[model samples]
Target: MDGNRVATLVGFAATLVVLAGLVWVVGIDDTLAALTTADPVALAAVAGIALCWLVSWGLALWTVLRALGSPVSPHIAILVFVAAVFSNNVTPFGQAGGEPLSALLISTAADTEYETGLAAIASVDTVHFLPSVGYAIVGFTFVAAGAVQLTRNLAFAAAAVAVLALGIPVAAVLGWQHRYRIEAAVIRGFTPVVTTVARVVPRWSPPSAASIEARIERFFAAIDRIATDRRTVIQTFGLSAFGWACLAASLWTSLYAVGAPVPAEVVLLVVPVGSIASVVPLPGGSGAIETVLVTLLVSTAPVSAPVATSAVLIHRVGSYLLPTLVGGGVATALGVDHAASPET
Candidate 1:
C-alpha cells in the first residue's frame, strides 16, 4: 500500500480507539437508548443541511478561484471541494494532511497553476475564520444582552474563540510581512529531507532549492492576487458565513431529533468553537470535535450527557461519515490518489 493509504488506516484506527473510549465514558446502553429515540424528520433535515453546508463552501471555493483568475466550472469546483474533504477526513492535521492532493486536483480540474489552486483553497479556509468568529460574536451578544444565561465553561469557550479569531488575522499579517524568512525556513527545513529521500528511493529526483523558492514565490503571488480582489473577498466571506449557519443548523437539528433541543444561539456558539478543536492531529478531528460539541452542549443548554452524545453521533452521521463516504467516492472518480503526494 502507498503512504496515503497507510496514514489513512492509522488515522482510522486511532478514531476507532477514541470511539471505544468515548462509548465507555458516555455509557453504551444509555447512549444507544437515546439514539433509538431520535426523530426521523429532524434527522433528515440535519442530513439536508449538512449537504447544503458542503455546497456553500464549494461555491466559496469557486469564488476564490475566480478571484485568482483561475476559474473552474461550478460543478468542478464542488467536485474538487468534496474530494478535498475526503483527503482531509482520512488524514491527520486537518488541511495540512490534505492540501497537496487538493491543490493537485484543483490544478488539473481548472487547468491552472498548482500554486494558484493552493492559494484559492487556502484563502477560502482563512476567510472561513472571519465568519465563524462573526457568528460567535452574535451569539455572545445574545448572552450579553441578558437573552440567555451561559455557564462559565461556555463563556470561557467563547473567550478562547475570541482569542483565536484575533490571533489568526494577526498571524496572517505577521507571516506576510516576514514571507521571505518563512520561505527560507521552509526551504531550509525541507530540502535536506527531499534530498535524502531521493538518494535512497532512486525513482524520483529532488527539486533544487532554487525551484522550491520559485514555487513559494508563485504561491505568495497567487495569495496576493486573491487578497487584492475586494469583491471576491466579500463574496467568499458571505458564502463562508452561510456555510457556518448550515453547519450550526445541522447540529441544532441533531439535538432536536434526540429530544434535547437547544437554542439556535447555543448551536452557533458551539459549532465554531468545536471546529477549532478539529485542528488537532486527528483525522477529521473525529473524536475530539465530537467531545467538544457534547461538552459545550451540556454546559450551555439543558442537555443530558446521553442525549448530547446521541445528538453528536447523529450530527456526525451527516457531517463526518456522510462527507467521507461521498467525498471518498468523488476522490476515487477524480483520481485524487494520484493528486496528493505520497507523503500524505
Candidate 2:
C-alpha cells in the first residue's frame, strides 16, 4: 500500500491498542462485569435510538425528494438512506464519498434530474448542520460551566467550529454569493496553466471552461430553486432536532447502563462536543471517537475511568458499529437497480 494508506492503518491499529491498554489497566474482569450487568433500561434505549435515527433521516430524505417534485414511499426512503449510510461509513473519507452516492441513488430511483437530487441532498446536510451548529453554541455554555476540562473542551469546540466552517455547503454558499467573480477567477487562474500543460503533454487537453462555468451556475440555480419553499426547510430542521435529541438519549442511556449516569444537560453537551471528532477521516471515526468520548465522559461524569471507558464502548457499538453492519447488509440486498422504478 501507499505511504498514506499505511499510515492510516498504523494510526488505526495504535488507537485499538490504546483502547485495549485502557481496558487492561482498568482490569478486564471489572470491565466485563460492568458490561455483563448493564442496565435493562439502557438496552431498551437502543430501540428508541434506532427508530429515531431511521425516522429522522428518512423524513429528511422524503422532505427533500418531495420538494424536488419526486416523492417516494417510506420504504424507498429507508433503502436510499441506509445505502447512503453504508457508503459513508464503509468508504475512506466517508463524508466526502457519501453525499454524491446519495444524490446519485436519489436521482436514479426517483428519476429526478441529477442537479435537483444533488441540491436536495446538499440541503438535507445543510439543514442538519443548522441544529448541529446550535448545539455546538449551546454546548460551549456547558463547557464554561465546567462540564468538561477547559483545555479538552476548548480543543473539541474549536475542532467543531473548524469542521463546519470548512464544510462544502458553506463553501458552496460562498461561491454562489460570488458566482461571477469565482467563475472568472477559476478561468483566469487555471486557463494558462492548462494551456501550458497541454503544450507539453500532447495527448492531454483541458476541460471546457465554459462547461465548468455552466455547471457551477446550474448547481447554484438548483439550490435557489429549493430555497423557494420555506415549509420544507422548517420540516427538515424539526426532524434534525428530534433526531439529534434521540442520539443524546442513546448516549445518556449508555452511561446509565454502566451505572455512571450524568445529568441530562451533561449528556446534551458532551455528546455533541465529542461528535466533533467524527469528522476525522478514519472509518467510523474509529480511534478519534473513542478518545473524545472517553475524555468527555470522564470530565463530565462522576464515573471512574473504567466505567467511562465501558460506557463509551457500548455507545459506539450502538451508534456506529451496529448501523454500519446493518446498513451494509441493506445496501447489498437493495443493490443498484436503476431500472427499478420509484413509487409516486
Candidate 3:
C-alpha cells in the first residue's frame, strides 16, 4: 500500500487503541451498572435533552443556509446536518471532515457547484464560531459569578489564555468585514513553530497573491450576503448559542445518568475546555478528548475516579459513537461512498 494509506491505517489503529484504553479505564462493568441503575425518569429527561440538541443543531444549520441564499427545507437541512455529524465522527480530521460532506450533500440537493455549496458551508462555520465565543463569555461570567471555579494550574490558565487568543480572530471576522486587512498583522502573531508548520502543509490552496485576494473578496462578499439581514443574523447567532447550550446540557445529563453530580455550569465549562483540547486533527478526538474530559472532571468536580471515568465514556458513546453509526448507515443507504466522500 502507499505511504498515505499506511499512515491512515496506523492512525486508525492508534485511535482504536486509545478507545480501548478508555473503555478499560472507565470499567465496562461499572459503566453498564451505571446505565442499568439510572432512574427511568432521568433517562427520559436525557432523551428529551438529546432531542432538543438535535433540533437546535438543525435550526442552526438551516438558519445559516438560508442566510447564504440556499433556502433548503427544514427537513432536508436537518437530514443533511445529521449526515454531516455522522461523517465527521468516522473521519480522521475531527470536525473538519464534516464540512465537505455538508457541501456535497447540499450541492447535490441544490444542483450547484461544490464551491457554491462550500461557500454556504463556510458561512455556516463562520456563524457557528461566533456563538462559541458566547459560550466562553458565558463560561467566564459564571466563573466570575462563583457558579464555577477557575483553575490555578499554569497549564489550565495557559489553555484559557489560548482559547481567548484564538477567539480574537473569530470575533474580528464575525464583527467586521475589514478584518481581512489585518490578516498579515495577525499572521505575524504566530510563533516560529506555528509559522513553520503553517508553511509545511498549508490548509488553504496556494494561489497567486492576486488569486488569494480575489478569494478573500469572494469570502467577504459571501459574509456580507449573510450579514445584511440583521434579524437573520441575530436569529442565527441565537440558534448557534442555543445549540451549544443544549450540547452542554446533554453532557450534564449524561453525567447525572452515570451517577455524577456535576452542576450544569460546570458541564458547560468542562465541555468547552475539553472541546478546545480536542482541537487536534484526530479522529473522534481520540485520546486527547478523553484525557481532557477526565482530567478536568477530576479537578473541578466532586466525583470519584471511577464515576468520572464512566461518565466521560458514556458521554462519548452517546455523542460520538452512536451518531457515527447512525450517520454512516444513512450515508450508505443514500449511496454515498465513504472512500470518496469529502469527509473521508
- Which candidate should be chosen as best, given lDDT against the real structure? 1
Error of 1 at 341 (Å): 18
Which prediction has the highest TM-score against the true structure?
1
Compared with the true structure, all predictions reach lDDT values of: 0.84, 0.71, 0.65
**Candidate 2 residue pairs in clash (backbone atoms < 3 Å):** none
Tens digits of per-residue lDDT for model 3, 1-344: 38755755676687778767766776767656766766566656665666576667767668777777677788767666666777666556666766777677666654555666676666666666666665655664564466254466324834664565485566765757556755444444433445466688869434444544555566567667776878777887787778778777767777787677776656766766676644566665666777777776766667765677766766666567666666667666545543455752
The residue pairs found clashing in candidate 3 are none
Candidate 2 residue lDDT tens string, 177-249: 7878977898778778887888899889776778667766776777776777899888889998877788777
Off by over 4 Å in 2: 1-29, 146-173, 179-214, 339-344
Please state the error at residue 216 of candidate 1 in Å: 0.7
For model 2, state the Cα shift of residue 216 in Å. 3.6
RMSD of 1: 3.3
Question: Number of clashes in every candidate structure?
Answer: 0, 0, 0
After superposition, candidate 3 runs with Cα above 4 Å error: 1-10, 23-36, 140-158, 161-220, 333-344
- The full ranking of all candidates by lDDT, starting with the best, is 1, 2, 3
TM value for model 3:
0.75
